[model samples]
Target: MSYIIMEIKKISSVETYPVRHEVLRKGKPIETCIFKGDDDEQTIHLGLFLDDQLVGIISVFKEQNNLFSETNQFQIRGMAVLEEFQGKGLGTKLVKEAEKHCINLNANVIWFNARENAVPFYEKLDYKIIGDSFLIPEVGIHFVMYKKIH
Candidate 1:
């Protein structure tokens, strides 16, 4: 593959809506893209800009899961990359950036409820599944996946 310039930086939560809506929420209402802790002070949104276009986005919140014993945990949510950017490794890059930020905040683990179709993607990044898949109402089946980051 030829060289390409990729820019991933901290972005506002609102800036993540479009990408998440397009890639994750599709026919669902726009309000579905607005996560509960999106506007929290400790939440961080990362955007992957390819030639100035926001092709990938990820949001991380400082939330703990009872499944994990770690006191400092971060949950990654609303991670998406445009269809055109798929298979280009952009998703992996976005996740790595999130992990870096979580580490800086002394986060001991990074976890999220991965959509069934996305399980392979997170598994490739070394995340492990903790329990049986569960339904997320309108969102379909999901698995709780996590990776120790400290």
Candidate 2:
């Protein structure tokens, strides 16, 4: 029997670019993958590795959305799983891990701009849409989604 070794842990912001660019930026400039608060000391980047190969990544920042009443919130940004590994539940694992980290930080909620198609994925995770959908220029339409962690 063969076993697939999978591990998830904190990684530096710089370590996330390759996967981010490949999965999220695609045709856009690589700079588009570098989120605004990626270098902040409090920001958290989590990478999923399978047998030592980085296959997925998710970033969380200590940021608040005015749409949310919570003073303490963490915004999820640049979450993606390599195309070949999609539907394997690795994305769900990364998100669950992030939720644990956010809860530990005493966050009242966690939110993000969910791409139109990704809204269903977030919905399965118990995230709810906050407002009307909007466009992101290079990216497509997105809706603000959030889940109360407190």
Candidate 3:
């Protein structure tokens, strides 16, 4: 395996729409609704770039509360890896970088509405489930999971 250098950075205005659409369209069939937005929030969006190619991405939203009722935590949104990049540990690296960024922002935890199929992935990272499964329109069944950032 080639050494994959993952660089994380904020998503700029020009990359916003493209990233959103890519996450929605390529991520899953139901992602279109949850990702519906005009990119007008204080969310920190980060893309995983391998040299010059955009291969994976994740976003962290600093918040006091949301439907998940998580306070003093950062929410993970729009996590997706390019099909070709799957299984390269890029997704895990992206989440780790996001968690580090959240800790830097004084956040005590990082959480996400994780799809059922992804529960084990998050579980392996030690993210604890906090609630029963629920579905968001255009998004499939998911659970609110959280992991403390130390």
Candidate 4:
């Protein structure tokens, strides 16, 4: 069971759109605005391939805020592992890869607005909840979580 991870740009610039949409569609809550390709910043998608077949994906967007810190950081937006592959730790692996990518780029922290149901998963990876809960409409109720990398 070998797997490989690649940047969205490295595969095809247009490939990230459908994967992002599919993940959102499967998990979106009512009253939330649907995610569109334009919502994504340039060059932020990642895909996981196993045996040459694309099977999981995640998107990370970097943000720079003086209040938070001086350096740029990343926030995960889209994430999904194909149904047949969910329990195999692929989601965690995808996250670790994203963190490694951000760290390589000089990021100090990795953060995300994680959905309520996914909180335990992130907690296991050492991410801590940082703020009040909020609803992202189509995305669901989320809590901000962060993990320092630097």
Best-fitting candidate, scored by TM-score: 2
Q: Which candidate order results from sorting by lDDT in descending order?
A: 1, 2, 3, 4
Candidates' C-alpha lDDT: 0.94, 0.93, 0.74, 0.70
lDDT of 3 by residue, 1-150 (tens): 888566878775345445546654655543352453326576777878888677777877765445444457778877888777788788899899998888778887788788888899899899999868999776579888888765
Q: lDDT score, residue 117, model 2?
A: 93
Worst-scoring 10-residue span by lDDT in model 4: 29-38
Question: What residue runs in model 4 are displaced by over 4 Å at the alpha carbon?
Answer: 1-13, 27-42, 65-67
Q: Candidate 1 — what's its lDDT?
A: 0.94
Candidate 3 regions exceeding 4 Å error are 1-5, 13-20, 26-41, 66-71
Candidate order by TM-score, decreasing, is: 2, 1, 3, 4
Query: Model 4: per-residue lDDT, tens digit, 1-150?
Result: 754544332344245555554555654433232334424554366788875667778777766433366477777767777778778888898898888778888888788778898899999999999868999765579988888887
Please write out the lDDT profile of model 2 over residues 25-128, one tens digit for every residue.
Answer: 89878778788999999999999999999999999999989999989999999899999999999999999999999999999999999999999999999999
Each prediction's RMSD to truth: 1.7, 0.7, 3.6, 4.2
Local error of candidate 3 at 22, Å? 4.0
Using lDDT as the yardstick, the better of models 2 and 3 is: 2
